[model samples]
Each structure stands twice: as C-alpha cells, then as structure tokens.
Target: MAILVLGLALWVGAHLFKRIAPGMRARMTERMGNGSKGIFAIALALSVVLMVISYQRAAFVNVYVPPSWTVHLVDLFMILAIALFGLGSSKSNLRGKLRHPQLSGFALWAGLHLTVNGDLASVVLFGTLFVWAFVEMAVINASEPRPTPYTGGSTVGTIRLLVISLVLYAIITAVHAWLGVWPFPG
Candidate 1:
C-alpha cells in the first residue's frame, strides 16, 4: 500500500505540476532543454511499475463484494470510455467541444472500474485516477485562453474513430485474462 500510495502521488503530482506550479515546470523545461521529455518518460514508467506492483500486493485485501450486474454495466461503460478516448485523440470536433475528452474518458474508465470492483486495491488505483482526471480537467479548462470553435469532420473520420476504439477495446479485453483481471468473466 505504501508503494501504491507513493506511485499515485508521484504520477498525480508530476501531472499536476504544470497546473500547481507552472513556473516550476517552465524552469525545469528550460534547464533540461530537450531532455524534459526523457525525464517525464522515466517518471511515468517508474510510476506505472510501482502502481502495478503495489496493486498486486494489495489485491489480497477485499473491501466489498461487487454485484454481478455491475460487471455488465462496466462493460458498457468501458465501450463508451474507449470510444471517447479514440475521439479525443482524433482531429474531430470532440476535441474543440470537450477541450479535454481524454481526461473525461479516463475519469469514466476509472469510475466504471470502481463500480465493478469493490476492493482496497481497486479503490486506491481507480480513486486516485478519478481524482487526478478531475483535477486535470479543471486545470485544462482554466488554462484554455478562449473557447475554440468546433470544426466538423468527414463521416470517414467518425467511422474510423469508432472502428479504432472498438478494435483497441477488443484487444485489451482479450489480454485481460493474462492480466489476471478478466473484465468479462463468464
């Protein structure tokens, strides 16, 4: 739990650094020059590794048993979450309208997972992500200079986004068994 908490703190803190201390980020970027991205990559990798290890260690503690219905609901939510994430990355009107579709998608994903899994590990992982996403969204909205106009995209782009998201979701679902947490358990 200590490692998990520390990982979450580092991950969330690094992400929120820009929002909390914009000047500090600028200073680091100036000092590191092009190496800032490398430093960020290393931090991200370390956070992920720590999170995974901590989650696995903490999984032995069960906080609450989730209802069976929640599994089905979570599947539906995950589909929507994936679609939102896809659209968020694409050059679609969603980016302009939402201004932070990725963050919204992340929040949706974390929230949905929490609904399905009532455990200490799940709570620590998903809850932290939920909070981070909310803070990130707020920061992004506040940082935007002005409301950008939405630009409509072609039907092809919309279809492509849907297809990509569905494919990615399917791939992840397939690998869930290997991850030892099947999202769809029969």
Candidate 2:
C-alpha cells in the first residue's frame, strides 16, 4: 500500500509538474537540456512499475460490489476508450472533435477498470489516476489557449484508426488474460 500510494503520488506530481509549476519545470529543462524528457520518461516508467507490482501484491479488501451489468458496459466502452486513446496519433476525422482525446481515453480506461474492480487496491490505483486525468485536463485548459480543431482527415484515416484500435484492443485483452485477468466476462 505504501508503494502504491507513493507511485500514485509520483505519477500525479510528475504529470502535473509542468502545468502547476512552469517556472520550476523550465528551470529543470534548462539545466538538463534534452535530458529533461528522458528524466520525465524514466520517472513515469518507474511509477508505472511500482504501481503494477504493488497492486498485484496488495491484499484483496473488498470495497463495494459492482453490479454485474457493469462488466458488459465496461467491455463495450473499452473499445471506445481504446480508440480515443490512439486518436491523437491517428489521422481520424474525429481527432478534431476532442481537445484531449488521449487523456479522456485514459480517464475512461481507469473508470472502466474501477467498475469491475471493487477491491481497495484497485479502487485506489484507478481512482487516483482517473482524478489525475481530470485535474491534468483542467490545468491544461486553464493554462493553454483554445486549440484549433484538426481538419482534412479522410475516411481512410478513420478506418485505419478503428482497425488499429481493434488490433491493439485485442492484444491488450490477450495480455490481460495471460496475466490471469481476463477482460471478457464469461
């Protein structure tokens, strides 16, 4: 639990640093030059490792039992979540529809996981991340100007996005199954 909490804090702090403390982030960037990106990447990766390890090891303390229907909903929405996650990089027409598709997808992912995972550890991990995504979005919106929506994306791009998302989603499901957490409810 200690490690999980620490990881969560680090993850949130690292993500919020640039938005919350521009001056400090600028100073660190100046000092490290190109290394700043690598440092941030390492920190983020370490946080993920810590969270995963600690979460798996955490004792199962039941929080609240979720309705069985939520499992089906989670499965369905997960496809949309996965598509939104890759929207930023894809040339999909829907890319311009959202200002923060990736973050939105991340929030969706966390929320979906929370629906099925009623354990204290799962709640803490996913809830913290879900809150962090919203906070990050708010901070970015406050600090940044309105974005120009992307345009000129074709139907081909949209098809590509859906295809890639489906492939990636399948892989993710397989990985979860291999890890002893089958995503689909039997």
Q: How many residue pairs clash in each candidate?
A: 0, 0
Best by TM-score: 2
lDDT values of the candidates?
0.82, 0.93
| lDDT of candidate 1 at residue 118, scale 0 to 100 | 86
Summarize candidate 1's per-residue lDDT along 2-82 as a digit string, tens digits: 999989988997787776888888898999887886887788889999998888878467888888899889887888788
lDDT of 2 by residue, 65-166 (tens): 998889899989999999999998888888899999999999999999999999999999999999999999999999999888998687899999999989
Best candidate (score: lDDT): 2
Cα error, residue 112 of model 2, in Å, equals 0.6
lDDT of 2: 0.93
lDDT score for residue 2 of model 2? 97
